[model samples]
Target: MSDLPPNHHADLRHSGPSGYISGLTMIVGRGNDARLVADLADLQPGDHVLDIGCGPGTAVRNAARAGIRVTGIDPSEPMLREARLLTRLRRPAGEVEWAQAGVEDLPLPDASVRVCWSLASVHHWPDLEAGLTEVRRVMTAGGVFLALERRSPVGATGTASHGWTADQAAAFAHMLTEHGFVSTDVSNHDMGRRKVVVVTGRT
Candidate 1:
């Protein structure tokens, strides 16, 4: 875990109209991206998956459709509320639980998760290293971790502040390797209208 200060917690919260905009983005704009993460996770039936920085639970709902149980964790109460509402409306096949938490502080037991997915959310993490450590701690041996973030010049959002460059993606992949993750791969993917940097690692 990183020894850095924790001031980013305030930046993590999504409230007011921005929260609703984020929710709408997850629901309508990022469904394919969520499915890509779910596919990359290679979930097994009854597997317990964790969605860190899960905004509005879009990825949670997507993964649950494959019959894997999911827990969606985020620091934003408004996001969690939207997630719960969406879950009720979608009624995915697998069970989903929502938690008000953050990547630096996962509210789960060690080695409890079979897979972890974080989509378009890593930039908001308070401390990337600490968050990855927490993710590793919560995941079982050989568990998969898939994270996707928009690249700069994002065609859809045009939000560069939360986006990464190719070099940054490579650096993040190296960090994963240093943290004891094996078979780490980082690459850019064309997700229809937008480009994304995808990082996959295993514990």
Candidate 2:
């Protein structure tokens, strides 16, 4: 059996319209992960950024605070609702756009984003290849894709149902390379029980 924790959004029937809120709150309550993305993306003000699988707009709000034009996309309308609610809480500093969509079929123009990041949401993708392909298509040349995916064998259990295997990372790197991304770095970073691989690609 898979060792990953149950997805909070597994049942949307009773999840209400703010399912994204629960998921986002669970994934990123404060701004810790946003700081991680900031450090990885080295973002500057006015940069157009995309936060794929952006739960509750944590990264979106954080990026917006830095004067970055942030757009968040997710498949859950409930999540988007929470993101909208979260956006309402921002102090009208920067701009934030929200889209109810997924990485594989994003509602964004091609080669239009400066930074694209996904935190702790890669494993839920039904088609990682298609999702990454869409990511590549929407990123401008030299744009950054910081995908922090959970890796297997993170804890004493020696198995992670929620995390991807080492081979999976290599395959993702290869796919990114095939899609015209260069300088791909795929390695695991220990995050307590989760080993996240920060994949950066230059297109």
Candidate 3:
């Protein structure tokens, strides 16, 4: 009934409750295996973080371990429930805030956060521009935004079964630059059998 395509629902619910544990385990698992620390960049102690599309609070936990206040926003109630549980398990009672909201409709106040990190969720974004603008509005003047997304197929390893293309990554880079993030940088490389682009910018 929704005018959106069939994949729209799946994509829209990318961070939803169903299979959320597996999803978080897969991506954050990879980050952890590689010892991939966050791109805190210039963030200082006491800075607030907004983890868009935060799946199961991995990034939220990571930021909190660094002494930062973290707020995670996702469209899935199920995912938020897990986030809440994780926060309570590992952090103090009020250490983190988990909100059920989409990237294009974050519930936090404007300029309320010092950093925003979105990982492995860009391809699912319905309106990339609106999502980027929403992130920009919520970031402080010197805040940082780091987005890590899957890139086009460079070889057999980089190729998704659906055959992702480089053109998609390029379009996303243009979108990021147009939304006022300075020093936008996009990099692509082989991650085992997949290509990934790490996009970093400053608000």
Candidate 4:
């Protein structure tokens, strides 16, 4: 058995019409995480970014607005539809595309992306190892990968327990290092009504 920590919400698959509602609600209170991810990426104008589990394309569009090529992929059709509609209506300049995919399977060429990020989504991955291997495969030499989760209180329950505690963040950082990522780090930040932990590493 793998020694990795459990994915807190492995069975949570946001799909179907209810996913639309999730997407709409997702638009709220996520700007901080999205903007923070984009900032942490240190993106160049023409760089390519892949956002795994990119619900509603919030982070995708945030990166795209900086004149970069960005693809937002999610497993849910309804979420992708909502993302597409939102993108078309509030179009940000630069290349923006949406794909229906999950973390375990990415539809991009090998070593084709400079940055890969998952915001508030990694915990939902059914298989973290496969997801990380796929991420490492698609990233170019010297690429960056980041995963951000809300910093939840220990022993919390229900919706409040959806995020990671400090220990969980550290565990994720260690896993990142084990996956051949260099300079892995974990940090805590206060993002306005939500405290979050971010794990970053360079490949």
lDDT of 4 at 13: 82
**Candidate 2 per-residue lDDT over residues 1-203, each given as its tens digit:** 33333231222321464574466555443366677777888897667999988877788888888777988988877777777886786654778898888778989899999899987677666666688789988999878988776666423242244555566566666767887788788766665554566667777
RMSD of 4: 2.2
Sorted on lDDT, best first, the list reads 4, 1, 2, 3
Best by lDDT: 4
* Ranking of predictions according to TM-score: 4, 1, 2, 3
Compare candidates 1 and 3 on lDDT and give the better one.
1
Which residue pairs clash in candidate 1?
none
**Per-residue lDDT tens digits of candidate 4, residues 44-160?**
877999999999989998888878899999999988998999899989888998899988899999999999999888888899899988998899989999999988877777888
Candidate 4 regions with alpha-carbon error over 4 angstroms: 1-6
- Give lDDT for model 2: 0.71
- Models 1 onward score TM values of 0.88, 0.81, 0.77, 0.95
Whole-model lDDT values for every prediction:
0.79, 0.71, 0.65, 0.87
- Which pairs of residues collide in candidate 2? 20-78, 20-79
Model 3, span 14-109: residue lDDT tens? 433554654555445445412232653555777888888776777777767767788888777767777777667788432587888888888988
In candidate 1 the C-alpha lDDT for residue 115 amounts to 92
